[model samples]
Structure formats: C-alpha cells, structure tokens
Target: MSSFEPKIVTFLCNWCSYGAADLAGVSRFQYPPNMRVIRVPCSGRISPKMILAALRKGADGVWISGCHPGDCHYIEGNYYARRKFTLLKEMLEFNGIEPGRLHFSWISSAEGVKFAEVANKVIDEVRQLGPAKVFIKESPEESAA
Candidate 1:
C-alpha cells in the first residue's frame, strides 16, 4: 500500500515566504504538493485561532513562514510572528499537543532553493511523526450530528 499523504497547512507572508514559494515553483524545484498555502500580508497575521482552525479542519501539520530577520516589509512583523509562535509552541505543549506538528521558518523572496529545502525538511519531519491526531477539536456541527 502507498504511504499516507499528511495534510499540511502553510501560512506564508506575501512579501517573503510566498514569493520564495513562487520562485521555487518558477525555478522548477520539486517538492511534495501536500501543503495548502495561505498567503497573508504578514506572518504576524496568523492568529492562534487560525492555527487551531487548520488542525480542526484535518491538517496534519502546520507551517508558519515569514521574512528573514530584519527583512520584513512591515518592519517588524516577522519579529512579532516569531514571538507569537514561540508562545504558541509553549501553549501547545501545555495542552499535550505534540511539538512536531507545528513549525516556523524564515524564507526570503530570493531564497527559492531554501524554500524547497525547508518544504522537504518539514515534510520529512511530519512524515516521521506520522499524522497528527491529537488535540483535534470537533466542529459544533459535527458535535450536534
């Protein structure tokens, strides 16, 4: 039988990580297509509720990507995202969520190669950890049904 394809949700900053991902595609850098990319104006826009929503929607892994330090178009958006992700990591752990289910990284618009590398690496890590089933929340409709 074939291996399972883990569903990954990636939040990419429009100014950086999203461009890098676009570059990766233009450069023909091959990577798995298991990820659903969500383009945000800044990584800082990724709220905890959005992250939880992805998991609740059946995503097996989540990735948050932003500009490299000091390269954010919004000046300090990435810094805030970094800090928020750090706190989110701790909160997830406190709730018994596996740390491996979430990842954060910096990718610049010029780093097409880096984007592919990070994509493959994250995929590998999630694969090794298997599908994330813990901490999944039931939707209100599902609960009612």
Candidate 2:
C-alpha cells in the first residue's frame, strides 16, 4: 500500500555510528522517523541471533552501522563486524529472508550527513520491499492479549 511505513531496528556502534546519529540530530538533518536504535559498544559485539530476534519481533527491516575500516576504537572490531555480516547475509538468504531487508554501513563519528543519507537510503530500500512475511514471532504478551 502507498501508506505503508516500515519499522526498522537499528544497531549502531557507540564510538562511531551512534555518535554520527546524535550529531545528525543536533545538526537538524531530517530523515525518516522509522528506526529504533540500539547502541552497542562495537558492531562486532552484535550477534546474528540479535538481528534475527529483531526480525522475529516484527521489525520490517534491520540496519547495522559501525566504525569505518581501520578506525575501530576497539581495534579490528569493525573488521570483525564486516566478516560476520557477510556470513550473516548468506544465512538470512538460506532462511528465505530477503537480504535486502538487512542493511549495513561503515560510518565515522564526524559523518553526520552521511548518517542521514544512509538512514534515508535504508528506509527507502525497505519501503520498496513492503512488509516482511517470514521470521515474525508472536511474543507471550501478544498471545495473551
């Protein structure tokens, strides 16, 4: 439907992407209000289960942003995230989920504009796909009501 607005779950690295997001807000950059952000110490700390959990919990899309290559405060954390993300993408495909519903980016703390741009891009791509069908799990609270 033309009125569809997808819900996105976002994971951002504390030292980089999160800072960029904060800066984006401070700079008055306007982007779609579709994301629910979860800040982590490093993108490398994000487990595949967490992404899957987000999907299962009714997130229409998921985005992960981290430090640029060679700039992880934790040293090599972003590299680890990059490698894990590659494998995770394949896994999502194997499970019948469109990998396009998932997005990833490398962003520096100083890149506020870039953060807004990527946020808009991710939202547009997910909106085009409409709502996700698979991987949605009803929680106990939902079942109770």
Candidate 3:
C-alpha cells in the first residue's frame, strides 16, 4: 500500500531465470509490478558496467537471476556472474550506494513460484531502503570553477 514502489532493473539468464519469469507470468504467479526485465544469453555476459549503467539510468534497484552454478547452460556462466557480483558490491558501496540496492539469485526455468517469491522479496528490500540516489554529473562549465 506504500506509494514508494521502487523501480527495479532485472537481468535474467536466457536458459534459466528468463524461462522461470515467463512461466511465472503464464502461471499467473504474482509479485510486485516493479521490475523491468532484460533477458541475456547468460549471466556471465552481464558486465559490471551494464549494472552500473542501470543504476545511472534511474533504477531504484537491480536484481540479477541466473542458473545455479553447476546448472548453467553455458557451463560456467553463473560462476563468473557470482565473481562479478562480488566486485560490483564493493564498487557500489564505494560509490555511496547501499549494497542492499542490488540483489542476485540462482533460478532454474521450472521454479516459477520461486521466481515470484524472489521478486517480491527484492522489491520489499528495496522499498524498505527507499529510492536510490542516482549518480549525476555536473556540466563541464559548473566544474570549471
């Protein structure tokens, strides 16, 4: 019932999380209508810059869901994602962004109910943290003092 519905950018792996999301929709499993999904070939393909860009683009939070480490379609994609996720957490914290604003999970294509549950959880966590303060750059002239 809160008006502060956080806008979340969600990255899903094509072979796993993406399918789960689709299933969730088809099954009518409901979660908060806060996330905008971007399905990628694999979670390993998601770069830190991409995540940072989403935050810069005004997303209140980000959620990345991929195949379980051993179940990755691309063999080791999710493993790499986990590594990148750790680095990204440190970077976000250094940049003054709360680590809670970002979330990650491993989801197989069949777990539609789990997908919905995680979605709701992510939205709730972000909502509790309030809106993210996006990074803004000053104009060249403004910085020329």
Candidate 4:
C-alpha cells in the first residue's frame, strides 16, 4: 500500500492567520505541505456548514485560525468565531468525528514562528489519526457501485 499523507483543510482569517502563514512562507520556515488554505475575510465568516463540507469532501483534518482574542480586525469577530468553533467541535465529536481531526488557534501577523510550529503540530496530529473515513460523501456512481 502507498504511504498515507493526510489532507488538511485550513481556514485562515485574512487579517491575521493568513498573514502569519504568508510571513512563515516568506521567512522560509519549514512546515509540511499537507495544508490547503482557504482565506476568509474574518474568522467569524466561517460557518459550521463550511467546516462540515470540508470533512464531507474528504479532508482528513480541518484547522481554523484567527487573530488573538480581542484582536480581531472587525472588533468582535474573533470572539464570535471562538464561540462558533467550540460549539462546532462539540457537535462534530458528538457525531463521531475524531477530536484530533479538528483544530483551532490564534496566530497574529507577527507570529510567523508560531504559525510554522502550529502547522507542524497540526500535521503531526492528523498523521497520527490517519486517513478520514467518516462523513465522506462519495459520488452517486461510486456509492451505487
């Protein structure tokens, strides 16, 4: 069998986490290439449906990152995001999704090192969890076959 490499779907807030990721790239910080980033205007813009969709589409792991608490560009956006993430996490776990398959963090634009570190940590955790099998939405033909 071929080696397994988990596919991580990362939702990053444009004002902070995305900038930190960009900084990490520009600074040449080493990190795994397992993440597929989706930049959002703010963390609060990420809905539960978006995360669930990623999982259903076969993401082995999902990560959502934003500015530090009280540091959102939209003032209270991160606060809202934090609440949403907590509830979403609980709901997913209740429905049998592995806890290690989802993650959340706060990373500022100046924290490129932290960004890289978190990226490694997330990748390692997902690798330990192995490939995602739950909640994947196979095509109708595949399902029929």
Which of the numbered candidates is closest to the native, going by highest TM-score? Answer: 2
Give the number of the best model, judged by lDDT: 2
Count clashes in each candidate, considering only residues at least 3 apart in sequence or on different chains.
0, 0, 0, 0
Question: What lDDT does model 3 reach?
Answer: 0.91
Candidate 1: the clashing residue pairs are none
Q: How would you encode candidate 4's per-residue C-alpha lDDT over 1-145 as one tens digit per residue?
A: 1478899999999999999999999999999999999999999999877888789888999999999998999999989988998998898889888989989999999999999999999999999888887765556755576
Per-prediction TM-score to the true structure, in the order listed: 0.91, 0.92, 0.91, 0.91
Runs of candidate 2 exceeding 4 Å displacement:
136-145
Decide which is better by lDDT, 1 or 4.
4
Of 2 and 4, the candidate ahead on lDDT is 2
Q: Which ten residues in a row have the lowest lDDT in candidate 1?
A: 134-143
> Global lDDT of each model?
0.90, 0.92, 0.91, 0.91
Per-residue alpha-carbon lDDT of model 3 for 8-79, expressed as tens digits? Answer: 999999999999999999999999888999989999999887787788779999999999879998889899
Kindly list the per-residue Cα lDDT of model 1 for residues 3-118, writing each as its tens digit: 97788999999999999999999999999999999999999888877898888878888999999999889999899999998998899888877888899999999999999999
Q: State residue 3's C-alpha deviation in candidate 3, in Å.
A: 1.0
**Least lDDT summed over 10 consecutive residues: which range in candidate 3?**
136-145
Model 2 lDDT per residue over 1-145, tens place:
7899999999999999999999999999999999999999999999887887799888999999999999899999888988988998998889889989989999999999999999999999999999999755566765677
